[model samples]
Target chain A: MTVPTGQCCAPIAREPLAEDTAAELAVMLKAVADPVRLRLLSMIGSHAGGEACVCDLTDAFDLTAPTISHHLKVLRTAGLIDGERRGTWVYYRIIPEAVNKLGALFAPLTEPSPGPVPQPVAGRSELGLLPA
Target chain B: MTVPTGQCCAPIAREPLAEDTAAELAVMLKAVADPVRLRLLSMIGSHAGGEACVCDLTDAFDLTAPTISHHLKVLRTAGLIDGERRGTWVYYRIIPEAVNKLGALFAPLTEPSPGPVPQPVAGRSELGLLPA
Candidate 1:
């Protein structure tokens, strides 16, 4: 049987979510739900090269390399990160499309155009909650 | 002392995220991060009313009413959802501004205006990986 690897996640925006999509998103969110993962993402983003080696990560955090490796794997499986090995260390960086998709998903829901009459801000504000 | 409620979270888009913002987004993401909460957002959005009641939510899921209440509470605390007690049951809906802010943060970084006319997608693509 094929193990469910990265197939579960997709970009959050640009498509209507099926039930499977929700579950997939939940899984990705679960991967980043931990405090360690958040810190990892932050540190990686702030790194000069836009990526960081596991060796550097190990020195910054109190956790062991294996634990850091585990968190990085979680970020990788979630599509939030991509890692490459260089000699003695592995480096990881954020995946842009993944981040973009996630951003789009949480973006206010948009609706197809209705009547052609342009509405005012008040109407838009009221209608905004309606996902149009 | 005041409760550490909504102040903790801010939008993910724009600006260099201070350490506080990470924790805030983490909390907000933590809210919708749950499978049940995801379903709740779906059902609420698909609802004709653009809102949902605890009664409706309880009937939709297999979990007990109290469990549903707890989940809703979690969502509210995370600022991913807002609720109002109307009559006997409370109604909840998604907060667009909060969501918009979250979306913006995850959005690809944009560097200040610099250099000459825009380059092709290839340069943008390579630079895209680098937050320019």
Candidate 2:
């Protein structure tokens, strides 16, 4: 798998997002804009192997299996996670690029190494250093 | 202003999110789940001096001023932004702690300074460096 650099590391706050890009990203964001899906994505992304069996996930919630599947399906459809069938179980794991895109879109930028520190927001000039 | 640390820097992927936390974050996510709101946020965040006037934001969209105001209200209500009225227009700016929480929810962990690099996900062990 090819790793996308630069494009997936820049924060969305660095500039105004274009219309098409915002629309595309909105779909991705909408997919995680739910409590169940957010927890599923978090669980799958942080599981011991960086992946989780559907069986492991079902035990964590009071909701029915179909409901969990539905949420997982939404996450898969959003490109945030992928599932693979392995014999008796389907294992789910995060799609790093997709997750990275979410990170890139909002991650506070790392401190700039070469240039002067970013200017504080107009009215917030009282802050001596803008947290990157 | 009091600064919130630790709580906002830990990524959601660090562990399974608690249900209440998931529900709370989902509300925040819903606010930016739209194409227009995302763009509005980006524009305000990256704008000169880190804030934008309602007039500036209104001109960027083809929708009526009230529509733009509605979207801004969602972001503000979600605690992602704060606005102030100075005579003619209400100037809006990102709430850094809020934005940082969004960033923290997904930002790839920064390079580890003391501990060993995180183990590559179970199947993706082929990757030598997990890019932060």
Candidate 3:
């Protein structure tokens, strides 16, 4: 229930994330943590029109349609994907904002850092800024 | 026990991830899905020398030392972190390769995509390349 209300916290490599921020990200991360859900997201994101119908998605998995539907529901609850019923078939698409937020959360880890290790500043408050 | 053996796969937004690739990423993502573990990773990643001693990390949470240790063990098992015993304290550091891999996995989602939605080329095999 403690979902991130704003932009994702600064990347983990940049500074220690606040407890609440970590909790928010953990929820979304947990949503994509399962194999089936991760694949479902991928397929939806890469499909034509940046979306996939329920019929198309079920073929890629060994799971039953009901099981795939359940996984899609989980992704929807986590805000990773959005589903819309268009006539006879329901379609799903990746929520780019949600996916981008997760990418930003991990961005610092991918970039190289320059120079020596930072000195430990003691007793820093919650708002303390990491040295640049 | 499935894992990405070499580099991580192309981003999900770029193309549909192969089944084996999704399985590998899911395992690593599951490892970081917990709030406590995510916080632990952030702390180690941002700490001095890009590492943190167990003593320093324990004070940051209300959880007991053993619980913290267990979480650290999970991170280590997932290849997100490495710990070394230095005399009285155990120090943990983020594994940049692992962290970077996760970031790269999600990069396409963050960047803007050009033009219209991609066409679904029918009967494409596993090696089909995404349009550039």
Candidate 4:
């Protein structure tokens, strides 16, 4: 799949995010906002083969089967997880792009090559270093 | 500032996320889940010197001062942004630890020496590669 890089998706924390970029990021973030979904993602991310079957997922949570299905649907809709039906069971896996994109949103940018150093600007005067 | 590292904050997607790690990440994600807050973060992230003044922020959006303050409070409480009053204006900047932690959460994990290669497991052959 194709992923577009935006200011928020940039590797460094110095840059500001664009309006559209924040909105896009928010959409993905919203998907993980729920407690059930967060637990679901944790289970899926920790699942063998980096994926899990719906049958396996249902047993882990105390929620109803339909509730689990609904949460899965939200995750699938948000692009955080992907699902496929095979025989009697449906399997779900974490979408790397979605996860990576979320992860990349927090990457610390480097100046040249050394790596991003997290410099906490206490107050003012450091604004000059940010991008224009 | 001090930052916590875990399987999720490991800079690669291979390792499974701990339940606590997912919860922590979810807390931060929820902070950015709002439309107004997303805009605020974008403005803060994009601001010169990596911060924005409250006065400047108030004029940019159509929301009331109280509403803006509420959003800022949410961001502050979530650790996405930090603010301090300086006489007349309150300046808010993106917390580097918070942003970097999020970014690190998505960082591409390097295997051995080269780098992480996104391996798309079609079925179940790749289950062995995951952590126990």
Candidate 5:
């Protein structure tokens, strides 16, 4: 049996899902199934240099810093995002492999179009993008 | 103001999300954020004729009818799918617009590739597909 590993996930509609894979994906989906976390993930994934400082994320919402931290914590725990503390501020970036699993699930259903039309991102020198 | 509607959604990482949009998407995500529901959604979407009969679905799982019914109800309520009654059976098919919204959220982060590699689907003549 070929165990497909690190390939995000097989599309949701592709075949009968293995019980283990479904549970794993459910946990990840639960992580972003909130208004705050969804917005936070969007903000980070779309941010300049493909990463954002936690200090900046807190400023966007009316919630307390601790509240925002809690949401980020959930996302991090689910493996959707990863954080790094650099000096005074911590930075976060999307784990492409994690997010890609979600895409493979539902994207195949849509008719083909441009991959994803990217919004203009200002390349910032401050948040040094970590090497791949 | 050109409010984008019926266009699925602007990609999550493309820009900061509007609050209302994020909330709506969260509700839908919450529906499939379950282990059973995710598997259920996959089974239906990948099924022949792009839909599945409720009676046929229950046979695949170990749970009782009511348990499966409850999960189906959640998926239906969230607008991820639509159902129609035909004689003794109720058939369900994905609501493309809703599922597409999820794709828009996460698909963009992955590198451009073939839209979705479709799995081999055996066309069943029995599941009379309802007209679009």
Candidate 6:
């Protein structure tokens, strides 16, 4: 399979992302934006040996097999996970680089504020940074 | 405004997130899943003084003011950004804690993998970690 590119992009907080780059990121983020998909990703990432089979994942959800399969497919299409069949079962694992790219995207926003905190600008309120 | 809760949840890679926790995360992620919203976020995050007024943001896009306003509203609703009116303009800035929560969600996935690589299990393919 072809490896995904764009791993080297700067964090969003460091600079404004180009439009095309933002589009690509939005696609990936959209894929993992569902509760089921996020849980599936978590399960796959934290599973023993860093992988889990489709059968194992289905039991954890109240949804049907096809629904779970659909979520996994979305993750794979987004390049966030991969699946390979072995006999009658398919095992999935997190794509570390993709996950890392996401982490890097937000790293600047999350990193502790550096240098002195700038006073709120002359015409802006100081209410923007409060925890959501 | 009431501060949003759930800032202290563990990263998704550290363990399987609770159902409700995953739901909340999904809501926030879904809000950021659009291309325009992502670019707007990047612009707000990287702007000088780490904040930008609505008037400034609208110029960066090839979109109408209303369209840009809609996108910014989405970001604000997601808790990723905050906007407050000062005079005739509303300035927006990243919500450090919310962005940090997102970064932390994937931190474990991105952190250098720990320990020796495990042998591929008997029934699974070893192709899952390839970048992408």
Error of 6 at A126 (Å): 44
**Taking the tens digit of each residue's C-alpha lDDT, what string does model 4 give over B22-132?**
667778778878777877886787678777899888887788999999999988888778898889989998777677776766554333223233333443333222242
Query: Which residue pairs in model 5 clash with each other?
Result: none
A89-132 per-residue lDDT for model 4 (tens digits) = 78787766577666665655545334343322212111111123
Mind giving the per-residue lDDT tens digits that candidate 5 earns over B1-132? 122337645566656677777888888899989989998898898789889999888987889999999999999888888899989889998777777778877765433222232221232112111121
TM-score of 5: 0.78
Write out fnat for all predictions, comma-separated. Answer: 0.28, 0.66, 0.62, 0.41, 0.66, 0.60
Clashing pairs in 1: B12-B105, B13-B104, B13-B105
Please give the range of 10 consecutive residues that has the lowest summed lDDT in model 3 chain B. B119-128
Choose 2 or 3, whichever is better by TM-score: 3
Cα error, residue B65 of model 1, in Å, equals 2.2
In the range A1-132, model 5's lDDT, one tens digit per residue, is 112554545567556577778888899999989998998988776665566788777877889999999999999999988998877678788776677667767765444333342222323223334343
Task: DockQ each candidate and list the results.
Answer: 0.19, 0.32, 0.33, 0.27, 0.28, 0.29
Model 5: DockQ vs. true structure? 0.28
Error of 5 at B101 (Å): 1.9
Docking quality tier of candidate 5? Answer: acceptable
Model 3 interface CAPRI class = acceptable
Query: Can you write out model 3's per-residue Cα lDDT over B8-123, one digit (the tens) per residue?
Result: 66677767777778888888899899998888888777665676778778877889999999999989998888888877667787776677678777775445656433221222
* Number of the top TM-score candidate: 3
| Candidates' chain A TM-scores | 0.66, 0.75, 0.80, 0.73, 0.76, 0.76
Error of 1 at A13 (Å): 11
| Strongest candidate by lDDT | 3
Over the stretch A1-132, how does candidate 6's per-residue lDDT look in tens digits?
Answer: 111342445666766778788889998999989999998898777665776888778887889999999999999999998888988778787776677778767664445555533222212111111123
Error of 2 at A102 (Å): 1.1
